[model samples]
Target: MQFTIAEIWEHTGLFARMIIFALGAMSIASLVVMAERMLVYRKSRSESRDFAARMGAILAKDDLDAAANTRPDKNVGHLGRVINSGLTAYRVSSSSKDVAVESVARALERQAQREVQSLKRGLGVLATVGSTAPFVGLLGTTMGIVNAFNLMAAAGSGGLGTISSGIAEALITTAFGLLVAIPAVMAYNFLQGWVDARSVDISESSNEFLDMVARHFGGSHS
Candidate 1:
């Protein structure tokens, strides 16, 4: 007996068909998340880099007021947001140098955490799809096998056609599951690495901003 996709699909019961459709949806969702995240990260990095270069020049002059009021269009990137938070605190604090520094540090930390969490949005969906797709496929496979056995029992046949059809029905769901799962796992790992690298960039840039703040306040980076 020869099996084709259409043949196998025609033989599959309602539950197995639903499983395949669900897996297809999962694959589509993963791809959409990957594309969206990639675009967001790319835009964020470009904007942050440009903002850093411009701000670095301003901060190098030890011009706290200039940096604090440097709101260029308010379309800032991740690093810019963190740095801007510190600058906002610096601009408003009428307290002593130590108190201002503490406040600025706190602001930077809070914004950095928010930025990181924002970058990590939709990652949980990828993680869930990667970890669960296989099991979901297995569930479909189980149903397929049960249906195949029921058909065989109804026909009261132990022939080659019956056995082959049963095997095809039982295995197609598993194959579809893996097809959906593998790419999701890969995309999750790649995007996750990007987030990690961006996190490091945020941390390092936050430190640099703090140093500039301290120096402008006539203190040290420490």
Candidate 2:
């Protein structure tokens, strides 16, 4: 009637094993997303910081040509793209100051939206895994209990061996589910926070860029 950990898996029904395997797959997916997102956010933060420092110095001198000439660090920083878009708009627009500011503002807004979308990539997977993993485990547990009872019925006796296997299956699945879900939830929250911070930084950078344009071009804020 006694079972070791190895014996538990050996006795686990096919359906229960399938559930555990599915949970494993979900865990792997979450981990992959987490690693990928971390790398992206880290690069974005570092590049954006460097861009901000350099651009700040460039903007302080109120040099339109220099600001417009600023190049992104090999297409890393979102701020670089935003500034480039605005500057391009400013240069191509009609000589009217109002028209230039409006164009720049529109370009910056469009670029900001694109950057935010990029930052949000792969986050939905984290959310799905966090919210649904437990339910997947619960389904396994339920099926395991049912299988145990069916075995007991066929054996014509309520024996410990017949029931213990099912109980173990249920408990193992629930534990595995929690293990998978907890880290996923944590990762989702952390990454979401990182995205929010990046958004704020992008917004601040856009605002500062717009303000500089207004100051130099004699136009009100767009």
lDDT of each: 0.86, 0.84
Candidate 1's residue-wise lDDT over 76-156, tens digit each? 799888888898999898657788888999999999999999999998889989999999999998887787777789989
Pairs with steric clashes in candidate 1: none
Q: lDDT tens digits, residues 54-143, model 2? A: 877887888877877766467547777777788888778776777777888999999999999998999999999999999999999988
- Candidate 2 lDDT score at position 183: 97
Model 1 Cα RMSD, 1 decimal? 2.2
The list of candidate 1 runs beyond 4 A from truth reads 219-222
Candidate 2 has its poorest 10 consecutive residues by lDDT at 213-222
Give the clash total for candidate 2.
0
Per-prediction count of colliding residue pairs? 0, 0
